[model samples]
Target: DQQVKQNSPSLSVQEGRISILNCDYTNSMFDYFLWYKKYPAEGPTFLISISSIKDKNEDGRFTVFLNKSAKHLSLHIVPSQPGDSAVYFCAARLKAAGNKLTFGGGTRVLVKP
Candidate 1:
């Protein structure tokens, strides 16, 4: 079974609106949670992340929330833009695992103008 999962295969939002993407995990040993954005034929770029010890982390319009009790997390994009349209992925790693990340099936975000 996959350790990380993104139940939503896709999400659509209008420009300037908020796009919320959800993720679930089975491993409690994870030390870090991360979100990445990628365009077609391009490598995924890190967007935002949160330590397992923290509940939330935000950078500009992107925010990541973690709930250890539920083994769940979510990524929120406020004021979504067309430039933000891409495939978003949720990934996690155990500090002891030495930077090996378990990635969830990505969620495709369509930010329509």
Candidate 2:
């Protein structure tokens, strides 16, 4: 099954705190992993990514860590801000699948100021 799952549909955090979002996948063939952030009524923008060959990737305030053996991944945002409130989607792609990505439903985060 190609289910890229984000178990929690929503999260809330106070500004300046750390926000963590989790994702899990069952497909062993997935090699490329990506995370996207979206605002209301807008398309998702790429956040960070990690390959099956690596365990962690970080970009500015955002960081992503992968545990290949466990089929788990997590995104961490440090010093979360009110503007950071949005929906985050985790995606994966199998090279054999032609780079087509399957996305998780999404997790909505609200950073309260």
Candidate 3:
């Protein structure tokens, strides 16, 4: 069973719209959550993250929200662009879990212009 899960396999959005991706976790031990974007064969690039202590965190074009009690989190990309098309993964880790990150399957996003 996957500790972290991305229920949506894929998503599509217009170039200038917002893109939302969702994830859920089963472990109450997870203390940190992060979202990553990956291109073809390259490693996943870190996107936005939120600590369990915070409800939300935001970057320039990305935002992450966490609901500890519900064990859910979501990533929001504002004004999605064509270049943003990629496989987005949700990851979680326990501060005491030896730095290993548990990852969700991934959500493929397509931004159409």
Alpha-carbon TM-score of each model against the true structure: 0.97, 0.97, 0.97
TM-score of 3: 0.97
Error of 2 at 97 (Å): 1.3
Query: Per-residue CA lDDT of candidate 1, range 1-113, in tens?
Result: 99999999999999999999999999999999999998999999999999999999999999899999999999999989999899999999988878899999999999889
- Root-mean-square deviation (CA) per prediction: 0.7, 0.9, 0.6
Task: Please estimate how well model 2 matches the true structure, expressed as its whole-model Cα lDDT.
Answer: 0.95
The per-model lDDT (C-alpha) reads 0.95, 0.95, 0.95
Show where candidate 3 strays beyond 4 Å.
Answer: none
Could you give candidate 2's per-residue lDDT for residues 8-110 as a string of tens digits? Answer: 9999999999999999999989999999999988889999999999999989999999999999999999989999999999999978977889999999999
RMSD of 3: 0.6
Q: After superposition, how far is residue 69 of candidate 3 from its true place, in Å?
A: 1.2
Which TM-score value belongs to model 2? 0.97
| Structure candidate 1, residue pairs in collision | none
How far off is model 2, as Cα RMSD? 0.9
**Pairs clashing within candidate 3:** none
